[model samples]
Each structure stands twice: as structure tokens, then as C-alpha cells.
Target: MPTATPSPDFVAALREYQPLVRRVCRLYCQDADDRQDLFQEIVLQLWRAWPRYVPQPDAKLSTWLYRIALNVAISNLRQRTRRPARVGLDDDAARSLAQPTESSAYEPEEMAALYAAINRLSDVDKAFVLLYLEDRPYDEMADILGITQNNVRVKMHRVQERLRRLLVPASTH
Candidate 1:
């Protein structure tokens, strides 16, 4: 059996926006192996779907990528028999996260705690978090998520509130 070679165009595009894909994997898979598996799955799905992709002025590449990545991650989560507890960031996952343009916003411990809390969120909420963290604008997020910009804003607020509650120590609550 032989495998079809991926086109140069697909390769180049994926290489460019891989961090977006990695962000999705990091949010969904805590284990290194699981992350790797999910990444491969996403690439495979993207490649298979490549020919069907019709680039349009209104449809940003990132938006299409997010839809696929989030769908794969959510579907992968559903197929998991055991959802791994996210205690800390794996080194690779940490390295792959989209960094702040300026100084680091959170301390290392704070970031780890934040990720753990994010892991506790439902799959849909997790999608919201991933997009928000990627610094995606509300309009782009709405397009990616197939919702109105207003809905994206509302969901983002609720997701943020959930994270705040999750981060608070039980004793503090």
C-alpha cells in the first residue's frame, strides 16, 4: 500500500499555522502521547479535507482551521474512555502555547493552575477558551464557531466567569 503525498501548498499552510493546531491539542490532551496522537489526527483530517476547501474572501484560513481542529478535539474527547486529570503542564504543551506579545501575564504556578481549571470545563466551553486565548477577535470567533458576534461575546463572558470560579480555592468560595 502507498500513501498519497501531501501537496506543497498544504504543507506550507500547516507549517505556518501549526501553533493554532497545537493550542487546540494542548487544551484537549494533557498527556504528551495523547497530544501527539491528536496532532497527527488533525493533520490527517486536514489533508483529507484539503481538496474540498474553497478559500473565500469572507472565510479566513484561521477560521476554517479552527473549525476542523475544534471538531477533531471535541470528537476525540468523546471517544476517550477515561478523561485524564490535568494536574500540570507537560513541557511540550507549555512550549507550544501562544505566548503573550509583551511580558508574561501570569506566574508559572498561576498559569498551571489556570490550565487545570480550563481542563475542567465542558468541551464547548473549552472551545471558547481556546479561541479567546488565541486572541481571536469576536467576529472571527463567531465565524469560526458558526455563531453571531454577539453570541461569541456572551459565551466568552460566561466562560471567563466559569474560569474565575474554577480558579478560586474551595475554601474561598
Candidate 2:
């Protein structure tokens, strides 16, 4: 079957939102190859769904993009089987991992530990974390997650507590 081409508006929107999509992929995918695959799958799904999207005056485009990306990532993660552990990072990846971002408040090691903790979270919890980290308003997050604002608030507080427990060493408790 011939594939439908993405509309010009869709293409433009995708290009504009690519970074947000990539961030979602990174949060869900540990491996570079897996991230790439997830990114492609998200783009494909976005293109397929674009025709159905109706822009509401009060709705933000980022919220819509995030909802679709998170859904795709969560679905993809569930469908994937475990692969053999990666032996080592490539030179570039190693360097990147070792180097902390200049603007980041945390050291490289601290950031790595934080990411490791995040990776341990359940998919739904991870979605909560991602939305919170993005500084999304409660209303937008509730809409994206298809929950009430009160639920979003309750879940977010729980997620924060869980993350704190994960990050704190038992020896220190």
C-alpha cells in the first residue's frame, strides 16, 4: 500500500516539536539504537494521527505532542523483549555521558544516578515525572494523562516521594 504523505502543516509542526519528541524517546529508551527506533515510530504515529487532530483554542500543541509521544513510548516499551546487556558505550557516548551539561545544576555522576533512578520507575510513573519535569501545568498534564486535576496532583506527589526513596541510600536512612 502506498503511504500517505504528511501534510505541510504536519511536517512543520513535527519539525518544530522534534526536540520534545526526542526527549520523550530518551526518557524511555536506554540504548541509542532503541531511542532512534522509538523516535521514528513516534514520528510515524504522529503523521498518521495528524489528520485527526483538531486544534482547540485553549489547547497547547506541546501537550498534544507529548500525549502522543508518551503513549507510543509506553506501548513500545511493553511490546519490546529484553535484549542482551550492552557491553560498553561507544567513544562519543562515553564522552557525552561523562560530560555534564554546563547549564545543569548537578554533576555528571549525580545526573547519571538520577537518570538511573528514573529508569527504574514504572511507565505510568515515568510519564508523571516527565510531565512534571517539563513544568507543565496541572490542567495540561491532567488532560494529557486523561485524569482529573486532583488525580494528577495526588499522583505527582506520590511520584516525587517514590523518586526520593529511590534516590536516597538505605544506609543513610
Candidate 2 lDDT by residue in tens digits, 56-150: 99999888999999999999988774545543344454445446767788887676767777877899999998888888999999989999999
**TM-scores of the models, in the given order?**
0.86, 0.88
lDDT tens readout by residue for model 1, 41-93: 99999998888888998878888999999999999988884665555566655
Alpha carbon deviation, residue 95, candidate 1 (Å)? 11
The list of candidate 1 runs beyond 4 A from truth reads 1-3, 82-103
TM-score of 1: 0.86
Q: What's the lDDT for residue 149 in model 2?
A: 100
Clashes of each: 0, 0
Model 1 gets an lDDT of 0.85
Least well predicted 10-residue stretch by lDDT in candidate 2: 86-95
Tell me the alpha-carbon RMSD of every candidate: 3.6, 3.0
Worst 10 residues of 1 by lDDT: 92-101
Evaluated with TM-score, which candidate comes out highest? 2
